[model samples]
Target: MNTSRLEAFSDGVFAVAITLLVLQFVVPDVQSGKLLAALLGQWPQLVTYTASFLTVGVIWVNHHTIFKGLRAVDRTIQFINLILLMFVVLVPYPTQLLGRYLNSGFNASVAAAFYGVS
Candidate 1:
C-alpha cells in the first residue's frame, strides 16, 4: 500500500497548505496613506488570513482524526487522500478573493458564499 509514501504525501500537502495560509499576511504597500486608512484597507487581508488559517488548522486536525482510525491503506485510499488534498490546496484562492474584495457589499456576499463552499 506504500504506507510511507501516503503519509509523506499527506504531510507535505498539509505543510504547504499551512504555509500558504501564513503567507497571506504579507505586509501590504500603503505608501503615503493615512495610517487609519491603510489599516482599514488591509482589514480584509487580516480577516481572510484569520479565516483561512483556522480553516487549514481545522482540516489538518480532521486529517489527523481520520488517519488515526486506519491501520493501513491501499491504492484507492491513496488516490482518495490525494483528491482531498487537491481541495485543501485550492483553499488559498478563495481566501485571497475574500481578502481582496471583502470591503465591498457585493464582495461580502461573495465572501459568505466562498466560506460556505470552503
Candidate 2:
C-alpha cells in the first residue's frame, strides 16, 4: 500500500473523530440562565475532551513521524498499521464515557486507568 494513501486515510479519520467529539456535549433543555451554569458544571467533560484531543493529536503526529521513516510496508506491516488505526477509532467511546459519568466518580478513575494503559 502506498504510504501517501495510508496517511491520507488516517488524516481523514482523525479529522472526522475530532469533529465528532463535540457531539458528546449535549445541551440541556433548561432556561438560558441555567444553561451557562450547566455547561460550566460539566467541567470534567471539557477536560476529558481536551485531554483526549491532545492525546489523539500526539498519536497522529507520532504515526506520521514513524511512517515517514518507513521505506515500504509489507502485508503484515499494513495489517499492523490498520490495527493501530482501529484503536484510534475507538477513542471517542471512552472519552464520551468518562465525560458522561465524570461526576459519579467511578468513570474518572477508570478513565485514568485506561489513560495510563493507553
Clashes of each: 0, 0
55-86: candidate 1 lDDT, tens digit per residue: 88898889878887888898889888889999
Off by over 4 Å in 2: 114-118
On residues 1-118, what C-alpha lDDT tens digit does candidate 2 reach at each position? 5688777888888877777677788877788689888878888789888988988899899999998998777889778888888887778878887887777777678866675565
> TM-scores of all models?
0.81, 0.85
Cα displacement (angstroms), candidate 1, residue 86, comes to: 0.5
Task: For residue 102, give model 1's deviation from the true position in Å.
Answer: 0.9
Please list the C-alpha lDDT of all candidates, in the order they appear.
0.80, 0.80
After TM-score superposition, what is the CA distance of residue 69 in candidate 2 from its true location, in Å? Answer: 1.8
Quote the lDDT for 104 in model 2.
70
Instruction: Candidate 1: list runs displaced more than 4 Å.
Output: 30-37
